[model samples]
Target: MSQMRLSLDQLTGTNRRAADILLGNDRGGYTVPSAKLYPFQWNWDSALVALGFSVFDSDRAWQEVESLLSAQWDNGMVPHIIFWKEEKSYFPGPEQWGTTDIAKTPPTSGITQPPVAATVIERLLAEDIDAHRDRAAKLLPKLDRWHQWFLDARDPDGRGVVAIMHPWESGRDNLPDWDRPLSFIDTTGVGTYHRRDTDIVNKDERPKNDDYDHYMALVRFGRDCNWNTDHIARNCPFWVAEPGMNAILRRAERDLINMATLLGQDDIAARATARLARLDAGFEQLWSETVGGYVTLDLRRDEHATGLTSGSWLAMFAGPVEPARATKMAATLTYWLSQVKHGVPSFDPNHELFDSIRYWRGPVWAMINWMIATGLIEHGETDLADRIRRDTQALIDQSDFREYFCPVTGRGGGGTDFSWTASMSLYWAA
Candidate 1:
């Protein structure tokens, strides 16, 4: 309805192929045969893809989360990746998980990712046709139940903030900022492992064999524990308080509350109201007066990222940061994003751990940019907001929907003709 700036009709042949990947690969329901770098059913990928589907099918949007949510463990934790099959390219498949009879995996990652599913669902419902909204209204109770899973499982500290279960869940893989904390866990014992992702994609584009070994070592620990919930909550190397994870959690709470009211679920709405206040208070406290913005979680000590990332820009999405806090956040976002030759490096360039090409290290993901742009727009910083929006639109138009991009040159990075990027380009750029 907001008149698409880039129409579906205008999409070039490559973009058409990119958008259709989901429909084409959509197995049975939400099943996606992902790239080897990320072979499992990724949480955020599914959520974003569902957002695209809502443009056409609202019922399916809810099902996207429902399918993932249905996979939630009894403890309320939603694993980051769900493996549906055994493959050569992917390591740590459900077979590797060895938890609950690999065949009946109830979602695989012992850890959680950023809680974007609820927020995406909430937004989808808001945009739905009257009948779809009515359907979401009926499903509101179930949605609230899913949000509770995050609150109960991830917020081990009860600081009203959630901690991420793994770096993979952050949708940022191998960021340098995570290096120091991860060093504490001795990964030499991760045992013999096979990698499937490398088989399908260029090896250079994926994590190195050594890093895969380390990633597997930790996961093997999970399998040894049968993906033990209690052990994972305490011992995992990557269980830090991810800034994006928490920011999305904030949005999820607020949206869940609104969703509650939409469906006349007063009691649940009241709980969400309180939860939103609690998380907001903790978020403002993470503001770094020294660096001037929200800090990403290190997980080991439970503090912010040692340096800056786009995670700081995510504060804009969390509804409201106090004015002084927001000013610091905005200043941090502007200064840091400008420092990268690539426009928005994953980790601070000043940090020794910066890797421009690693999956989540420095690649500028279109989805994250969309969140940042839309978040800033909501805060009324229209100029900068429009700058990212237009620039992102230009990138998609030029490179044509990549899995990720090099912000410096604006060339596509990682996988090409990625589906969610193409769909979000239509929805968000619109």
Candidate 2:
């Protein structure tokens, strides 16, 4: 399992480059995923970007989270994108969201991304508790409320798992897991709107126009409902219980409980424990022996979304799964690894829909690799974990810090100098 380690000079060079990317992307308190492509501060991006900042500037890392949390909605749900300043480069801007009245100071999209903040905060505090203790204390209650919002708004049924109303919420964008659910969404009246992403990156490397139509339709629906969770839940056609999003939420809740316990917040810890128990039980619905991995549950059809995605492996990372299931997932991961030069393709490389150059179809993202490897190590699948970590570092070394790399060719794709890509390189690629 031995792999090449970066020489002292190489290690310093990698860290310096990553730090420069983080600093270049920084916009006051928050960091953008990319300067031209994303422009706005994204939910999960900031959380991961904070980790990279912690490596060089601990104080800046704390400010990143604080700035993101400042835009939390009244209902405890954090918006997926915060329109901190006017930016015309990206599509579906603040006006498209039509949430000015409801959103906080800068205004934001109504939808929420994965809850990676609590897990990230715990890691930050662990690095330097004495310096970050006060920040963690203040963030815990807000994080608690944000976690509770999932239970109240997204999973009103008290089903241990929460449902993502939009693909953007999953943060995988064009993942094949949403294909079937997205197909059911009617884009008849989505109307005309320009997309700025394809303008910045090759359209071939980005999501198809058909995907955007469905995405925009969902956005319009949310806006029409005034971003009301209850209304969207009762009527929206695209409701899915995604394994990846749930795993992230579950892991965050687990970490939140630990953070609360450390901060002596017994009440927060107790509530998070109850929430985690339900999530642990409900997560079973996502497991599909048919796919040999955890798949998405289309709530509308009451059936599982058929596909083998990198997300399934997240269950192990977010686990307490039975040993048998973890072994099965590990085997599936190994099979996928054998099919590509880079490990952990976003979608199964053998799947008919897999396209190595397309975003979230079959590309390898460093952030995903970091999580999968971390989960593998936790489950004692160190050999496979090391393989993934090695492959990830190789991709970065050969391709530079791009948004993602082609699993088959190891070529970089999407936006260049991506924030989370650089962040993961610094924090996990070492």
Candidate 3:
């Protein structure tokens, strides 16, 4: 292990506590994103969780990835949530999805989340090439298919940036970026359904009642189309080409290019490189000089989103950007860091919709901090990156591995003992 990894392991109390929380959340092959709020293996959560496991248990890390892949759709789309076994704790379970009839695997959500698998795979391979090579090779084709699915199904107009049909797919369900597009979506026709999430976390911290109505409306819309990608791409009410998903997809595409070249798959490497270039070019459309960073675009409305959000910061993480633009984005991040006690609040502190205690509205998610910090480092802002890493660790240390932290008070909120929080703590601490 490197000196840094050794020092991280030596932080006895914090490291020990983080490891325990991670293992406690583990359910055989996959780890739940959290205990009560999110009980299933979530797509991006598992990928990030695996990166945490790679720090110590390489085998378990690979198992997390393999388990997620086991549910991959034949169409190459990997659903966002996998209902590994029946559980009553969560809402909109497999029954609501009505996808089993058409799906290739067991019950899973039809929509997909951010593609972080390629980034995680690259991390695992970097750790132990000899041990992970075979597994990485096995994962290549599946990851390729998943990437291809996004390009083919989500990006209808051949724009490198793809539209996320559901708020859930953006992974920032209630972020202000989607509000305008979501406003256009008519949810009155969708009937009531009991939400299990509020029971686990504060209703105020979660998406509001109206938000849920619109969310279910989108779900019902997709279900009625039998989760057919083509139809949903062409007709879904809430089609948004947001920055977060596009940034992550491009980052993943670039990583896949590296992995493919290592495996001597020239064809895959070529395709990934081409896709990455297109994504970088397409991101130009998302840039908002007024916001001083990339903002979500409501493709359906053909208008820029209302507020600056943490999701906008993800453009730094996706890959390289022009140096001048990156410098300005860094300056924008510095301004945001100064506005809140915690760095990288999910929503801009100055925004009208900012809610420090709410989940995505303004809380500082550890995972988000890690991504943005890492990206900042890659973009030559090591000082900012280090500050973010320290802030994230301090939050977990002070608040104890909660799902999200309040930006103003730094108090942990939402689900306690969250898997990704613990995982990211381990990662950033290292």
After superposition, the stretches of candidate 2 with alpha carbons farther than 4 Å from their true spots are 1-11
Q: Per-residue lDDT tens digits of candidate 3, residues 1-430? A: 1113433355467766777788899999999988888889999999999877766777888999999988899899998999988899999999888889766466899899999999999888877677778989999888989998988999868877888999999899899877778888888888878999988787888889999999999999999999988899889988989898999999999899999998788888988887778888888889877767788988877788767788788888998878998888888788888988887799989989899988899999988888898798898899999888888888887899998999889999889888888888777743
List, residue by residue over 1-430, the lDDT tens digit for candidate 1: 1222234455456444554665654644573534435555767788887766665555665777777666666655666777655545655666666656532554375656777877787777666446566656655665566567666666656677676655566667676656666667677777676666666666765667766665776767777877665677777766667677778888878888878788778988998787777788777556665655667656468565566677777888878656776676566567656765334555665556665666666667767877887788888777767667666677777787677776666777666556667657656664
lDDT of 2 by residue, 1-430 (tens): 1112232234467777877888899989899998989999999999989888777677888899998898988899988999999989999998889999999588899999988888889998988678789989999989999999998999888777788888999999999888888988889999999999988999999989999999999999999999899998888888899888999999999999988998899999999999999999999988887877789998888888778788888897786778988888888888889989998899989989999989899999988898889899999999999899889889989999999999999999999889998888888775
* Candidate with more favorable, higher lDDT: 1 or 2: 2
RMSD, one per candidate, in order = 3.1, 2.6, 1.8
- Count clashes in each candidate, considering only residues at least 3 apart in sequence or on different chains: 11, 2, 0
Winner by lDDT between candidate 3 and candidate 2: 2
Model-by-model lDDT, in order?
A: 0.66, 0.88, 0.86
Worst 10 residues of 1 by lDDT: 1-10
Clashes of 3: 0
Ranking by lDDT: 2, 3, 1
